[model samples]
Target chain A: MSLTKHPSVGEFLAGCEEHVNPYRPARLALCPMAADAEISDVSTSDTAREGDFVILWGSYTQIFGIVLKHGEIANNRFGNFHHDEIIGRHFGSRVRSRRGGLWLALLRPSPEFITQSLTHRTQIVYHADISLLRALLDARPGHIICEAGTGSGSVSASLSRALRPNGKLYTFEFHEERQKQAMADFSTYGVLDVVVSQHRDVCNHGFGEELKGQVHGVFLDLPAPWAAVPHVTKCLVFGGKVVAFSPCVEQVDKTATELRRSGYFDVRMLETLATNWGVKRQDATKKKRRTEGTTGTTAAQEAEEEEPKDVPKTSGTGEQWLSYQMPMRSHTGYLLVATRAPDGD
Target chain B: MKAKPTLGSHVVLRDLEGAQKVFLLSSGANRQELRMGKYSAIPLETLLSCPYGAILRREADGGWQRVRHSIEVAEETVEVQENNQHLAQDNSAQSLSPSEVRDLKQKCSGSEVVEALASNSATFASKTKFAQEKYLKKKAQKHVQQVTLLRPSVMELCETYYKQSRNKVCGLRYDYLSSLLCQADVRSGARFLVLDCAAGLVAGAMAQQLAGLGEIYRLFRGSYPEKGLLELDLSESEKSCVRAIHLEALESSDPWSSEWLRLPEAPGDAEGEAIAPGRAEARLTRITKRHNDFKSLEAKAVDGLIVVAEDADLCAEVLELGLPRLSFGGRVCVFGHHLQPLAALQGAWRAGNFVDVRLTQLFTREFQALPLRTHPFMVADANLCEGFILCGSKVGEAEPQEAAGEDSPTKKQRRS
Candidate 1:
């Protein structure tokens, strides 16, 4: 039942937007450590090149930039490094500025990194809200999804990944320029083929008839989602899901009231708080050494020597891990989810 | 997943009291109608192909009309509620007596009865729009014959059964279950060692998510409860994938024992497998399945380890005894009622091996998301016992490094 097809580069360019890459590499490679952290840098024809996005890291600070062979330089507080130096290099390989001893680590992109670094054309949805949103929608790898008001495609990007290769996201945005920019961002993010951006207002005219009776999930983020309730039902498949995100309680009340009238049931609303955590390895070397018949000076000096200090050893006092809530966004819009009737009464 | 309410499909019928009853859709049970309650019944043909969530209305005649798909909501807005100078304090607002209203209800549907009562109300026109809307909505909820058909899910099943008897399921929260599934990272094409004690709610959820690609080793302390999973609605194949293991057998060095892998006996008219040869062969079959599961489990480790046992000591036992059952980088999450058990379990894993041993308590607040009236739903369930979860992962375990100069304590007596 799963149409799990990972779109190839050619098919990816067929019907969706494609971003410009200075060098077109075959695949994406990620480096976990420094540009050169003694890890073997195996050269491959699939390494990153022009057009592919690469992250530059130095002194714990990282920046994402598109690769270019025009000798374009990426400048940050660390210094400036030419794009040519990064082109065709292994993702984990290090690069240096022409003059200063400034060093930068080149790496590939990931979901966690993209959520933080994506350039926003509008306010983007947080990753936590997106996860809970997908859960409410019963999102699987090959679900046919529809998204309205594609703000910055932050949620859309996550949806694109969730849809996988064979699935599709029919995302609509009323703003033409923002729609175009989101389309470009999807391509640069390597998931353009999985999403189809339409420059149209869904509430007034509806998501086209072709998608009617086939969509597995629908998500609305517009000011007037209630107006699109009829249209959402038209496009949603039987037993499918519809999620509407709104900040105000009135909007949820109206939307829920409308859904209550139709064949939608199991209506539930939730406000997802995405709590980030900071993990630090506790000092886990050893406990205090005990000895009898030792004098005060002897015990004091022995205790000083008994204190274990090893940096590379594993962590935790007796365990190896610790975590606390990180200072991050905790509140997002409330999500209202309902299911289409499995059978028409 | 086009879950049409065809013949013999499982469907849940919801009552006005927010209770749900599930049964098979059999038209033959009632020749002319689908018998719901003693008096309230709809024609069989009318419900034959009705959507699970559609609202069917009986006309003045013995016919029905459907308000299908989305509910036709009139775009009505209500301003703030004004002073109630024109309204009565209670039922005094209506002139009709209780017995008279009941008789009218027997003849007409709830909505029509509401309309009749509204027109007859002494102060119907005096109330503001907001007050009128709220009053009408509450009345409809109380009297409406409107029945919403719901597709059965883990949450609905638990909520329905929880209301009937919370003690049956041990107060497993819906939000907590969802969070556990996500944090445990359950997926298809993998094996999981789950210790579920939530009256099959957690097990049913994981089984549905696996979608027949993976295996669930459902460990229980005593004998497994077969009826607990009656409402799970898992397919035969999915059920077969879930191996019921007695917690005592998990301590055995051998996983091929009958307590660990209890494969059903082969078809036979006689007792004891009909023949010793057939019994021997079934044992072989059982052995192969165990080998397959354990080979991959020991190779890549299990995808995740989940425990929802109420016994607080079970977390420590599973971690100490079942750590090898999990693969590297896999999550081990234990769910319980209090933080005391988790505190002890956290201390048990203090060998610097497990990572991110977090003791978490989730507050699943239900808010009435109504503008100008948005507030948390005040209910008795909100005061239910709060549960705790301890989530950690199996990674690199390092021996505690000792001080460089601190030698092992030594004392000796010198000979004269």
Candidate 2:
């Protein structure tokens, strides 16, 4: 279940007949997981097979693993699941462990699940920011997008999904080791065909001369995104979008100014805050009696009467489910979105 | 190259006051017109030749003229007052009367009118630089009859509908819609079962993402709602991807044999007028396409299921019928305005064959980033609650042995 045993990018590429363009149907034909079936069938099917990746979701934990090696096992606190049990099962099937008898649901790998379970090499973009970015960038089929400093490949996975079937993503990361790891992860996740991860500091060298005026969108998750604004303009086609994710307001100000100065129109800044609500059943009858008693009782007597009691036996009909907001991360980062206008307007 | 608004294509006209109106750019007898305030209505034909994002201003002669270049007003750096304590509250700030202003507006262009008003304000010289800019911008909004033509993307369309009528779009904020799409992993070549009660906005948004590569089975309660969908400038291929099916057809024991699956006959010619031959042919073609799409959907599992209904009970019923058709690991996102029903749904779904069940509420705050003044907007929407979302992934039904062991200690722990 460990990625350490997976083949390196060079080794994996050497085994392929030609370069892999994940968007092309021919490239998917060469994928081992899709070899036994047509590309469309394999991509759309929910059944897990050998060489396919799956998420083992337990009550309190989630583990990502590949369905390979006949006798291999996925060891976790809940149980130890054999790969054989997972290979032929549907993605949402619950499989029990051999010895512990504990069970976990077998899930199909998605970008959101991967974001939660993937090994973190750096702070990664969560679901909220990634969703907004995809929408604002207009990432869709046939689009070619560029991302700088592909930290953790969190956003990359989503962009890859957004540009599925034919589009391409050229991602740049300055850290050599992180870039290699991200490439391996993408390969494992079956998105390497649509993504090209490279080791380059885009702020210094730019997104390569070949990409000049070719990309439909550019995304910057760097510390100083303003430094790459000029480079973004060169690579992005006229009317293309550019999004910068910055944690601080000062960075947004500088980036917005730079984008406007570079003739980008409709510069906007927004913060997405998402809160999870906890749903619990509240007993209705007890609450009515308590309210009636509280009107005449003294404050101290009410406090004494409110001492801990045994867990109430629920009368299902009288129970009501209520939701309350749970504590959440107040801030992730600011999303600054702007579109490049036609030149010399 | 920028995309131009073709004849008969829909475009959004945004006025300087931030109000928007959707117009079809066409010429001849079927031409459309946009009312410019209480005075003028300009034919949309004047915008067919302009590219998206082009700005047009109302001339003094009541004709629409395209602005070739955007005028950049340079801000003069002046010593500004820290507070407005010295400013007088008298209502005699403007030297010109309302009648005189009206006469000026009728004789001069919008910018000229704004300039005259600014010059006539007796207190304009003493106001802070920011206050002066705000005053000018407000005045310009009132006087300027300028409208910017924009392409109808989901973001623009959603904002327009949201501002005009929140209920029409089910109070779906743009961010929430985006989040739902992402959570559902909507993309090209992916099939989705969508129950869109939001005037086809959800289906249109998904069609944009599908980009003609996948299928969208738009389940409707009755006749299809195409008001929001028609506003989108989708190519023919993209339009083909959306297939409208009656909800009754999906709920029937055998959808193929259901009467609801059959296309209704075209309405009888009213007042003895004959139906156009071309229109009859188009109706036949549409019905045949729907049948084909329904057959294809029946044979395969969808990648995701999305239900946007005001009634939580309806959402639950649809989910129950749709879950069997959803692929394993496929996402289910149901949106409702009230939290009570969604919370009840959350409790019920956790016991079913689903994983990663969550109820989420989103809050989005926009900030105005300026060179010197960057802060959150002072005025907020009156309705703070956008809606609640219940999301989960469908799993396979438990096997016999797993069902037997469901009452084990682990099950008790989960409930606790």
Docking class of 1: incorrect
TM-scores, chain B, all models: 0.77, 0.89
Give the least accurate 10-residue stretch of model 1 chain A, judged by summed lDDT.
A19-28
**Which candidate number maximizes lDDT?**
2
Q: Write the per-residue lDDT of candidate 1 for residues B169-223, one digit (tens) a residue.
A: 6666665666677557564334688877777777777766554445677777765
Quality of candidate 1 docking, DockQ? 0.08
Question: Candidate 2 at residue B100, lDDT?
Answer: 96
lDDT score, candidate 2, position B25 = 71
lDDT of 2: 0.75
List each model's interface RMSD: 16.8, 10.5
Measured against the true two-chain complex, the DockQ scores of the candidates, in the order shown, are 0.08, 0.27
Q: Candidate 2, residue A142: CA error in Å?
A: 1.5
What residue runs in model 2 are displaced by over 4 Å at the alpha carbon?
Answer: A1-45, A60-67, A282-319, B35-46, B68-81, B254-257, B262-288, B405-416
lDDT of 1 by residue, A79-114 (tens): 678888778654434456676444454544433346
